[model samples]
Target: MPRWGMVIDLEKCTGCQACTAACQMENCRLPGEMWQDVLFYSEGEYPSGKLTWLPRPCMHCENPSCVAVCPTGAAYKAENGAVLIDWERCIGCKYCMIACPYGVRFYAEEKQKTQPDIRDVFPAKGDKVWDPPYKMPEQVQDPKHGVGVQPKNVVSKCTFCYHRTSKAPTGLKDLDPNDPATRKFTPACVVTCAPGARYFGDLDNPESNVRKLIAEKRGTRLLDQTGNRPQVYYLAGEAPVIPETRSVRKPKQSPET
Candidate 1:
C-alpha cells in the first residue's frame, strides 16, 4: 500500500499565496474556505528581518486524530493514506474539526453564501430566473472523487486532489514526483507552485523524491508533541540571511554668518 506524503521547502517559498489561490480555483471553493493557506510571520530586527511564509495543507497523518473523534464514520483514512470525509455520512458534529491539530477543517456553512455578482455576470435565461450563466466544473459531480457542487453543512478539508491521484496507473501504488505519470496525477497546489518548493509522492517508496528530500533536508513536522505523526514535512532553517543598512544622519549645519 502507498503512503502519500508531502514536503514543502520553506526556504524557497516567497509568501506569494499562489498555492492558496490555485487550490480554491481547482476545488471551486467559496471565498473564505481555503483548504491551502500561506501563513506569514516575521523574524529578527528591522532591516535585517526575515519573513517566513509557511504553506499549510492537510497533514493526512499516519494516525489521524480526526478519524478517531468522529461520532460517525464519516472521517476515515483512504488506501492511499489520505484523511478523507464522506459528506453523506458526516453529521455536522464538529468533532473532527476540534480534534484536528492543524486547524485545516472548516464547516461547510461557511461557504453557503452566493458569489457577489451572480445576477450581474450570470443573468438567468428566459423563463428560468434561477439559472446562472456558468455552472460548476463537471468533475465535481463524482462523489467518489469530489465533494460535489454544494458541500453544505458538512465539515470539509483537502483531499489531496483525489480526482487526479486516483487516476494513477493500476500497478503503481503511488505517483512519483519525477515521473510524467506522476506529473499528470498531482494536486493543483503541487503543480502550480511557482518556486517548485512542493513535492508529493509515496513515502513508502524508497526512491521517491518526497522521501529523499525529507532525509537529505532533515524535514520537520508541526506540533510534533501531539504525536499525530503528520505526513507533511517542512524544510526550513536554511534560508539565506539578509544584511541590514541604517541611514546615516548628516551633522547639523553651522549658524549662518
Candidate 2:
C-alpha cells in the first residue's frame, strides 16, 4: 500500500480560496463549515511588512494525535495513509478536536443542506446537481462510507475525498497527470484548483513528483514542533520586513502644585 499525502506550495498559491471552495462542494459541507482554510500572517514594520498565506488541511499525521485521544477510536488512519473519521462510531466527544494542534476537526451542529438559492455547485458554470448514487433529500447517505447522512452530534473533517478514492479504478490511484498510473486520478480540490497549488500522491515513493517537490524546495511541515508528524507540508513566501521603533516621552508635571 502506498502512503498517500498532499503537498501545498505556498509560493505557488495565490490565496484565491479555490482549493477551499472545491473541498466544500465535493464533500457537500455546510455553509460556514470548511474542511480546508487559508491562513494569513504578517511580519515586520508597516513600510517593509511582509504578508504570508498558508493553506491548511487535515494534517493526516503519521502519528495522529486525533486518533490517540479518540475515546471511541472513531478517528483512525486509513489504508491509504489518510486520516479519516468513522461517523457512525464517532460519539462527538470533541477529543480529536482538542487533540489536533492544527485545529482541522469540526463538529456539525446542524444538518448541512445544499442551498436552494445557489444555481451551480461550482462557479465554473456547471450544473449544481448532486452526483448520482450518493444523492439524497437535503442530506446524502452512504451506508458503506458511513458519511453524508451524519448524525447530529458527530465530528467531521477531511477524508482526503475517500468517497471518490475508494471507487477510483486500478492504475489510477495517484495524481500524476502525465503518468498512466494516475490516468483516472482526481480529487475534488485538486481537480478544481485553478492555480494548481495542491499536489497529491504517494509520499512513500521517492520518485513521485510530490516527493521531488519536497526534496527540491525543502518543504516544511506545519507545527513540526508538536511531534504530530503531519503529512501536509508548506512552501512559504519571502516578503519584506518592517521594523518597530519606540520614542521617549517627557513625564507629565503636576498642575497647580
Best by lDDT: 1
- Per-residue error at 201 for model 2, in Å? 0.5
* Candidate 2 C-alpha lDDT tens digits along 1-257: 67778887766788888888877766766565688887665545556655656677788899999899999878888887888887768787899999898788887564446565232342311212223233334433442343453455678888777765655554433585444555345566776667778788778888777888888877678768788888877655363211111112311331211
Stretches of candidate 2 off by over 4 Å are 110-149, 169-173, 177-184, 237-257
Cα error, residue 102 of model 1, in Å, equals: 0.6
Instruction: Give the RMSD in angstroms, all C-alphas superposed, for model 1.
Output: 8.8
In candidate 2, the residue pairs with backbone N, CA or C atoms under 3 Å apart (3 or more residues apart, or in different chains) clash, namely: 45-242, 48-241
TM-score of each: 0.80, 0.76
Reference-based lDDT, each prediction: 0.72, 0.67
lDDT tens digits, residue span 1-257, model 1? 66788888887878788899888777656567789987654555556655545788988998999999998888899898888888778778999889998889987554236567433354444422123323445555444433434344677788888777767765464464456867768888988888888888888888877888989988888877777899998888566321111112322331211
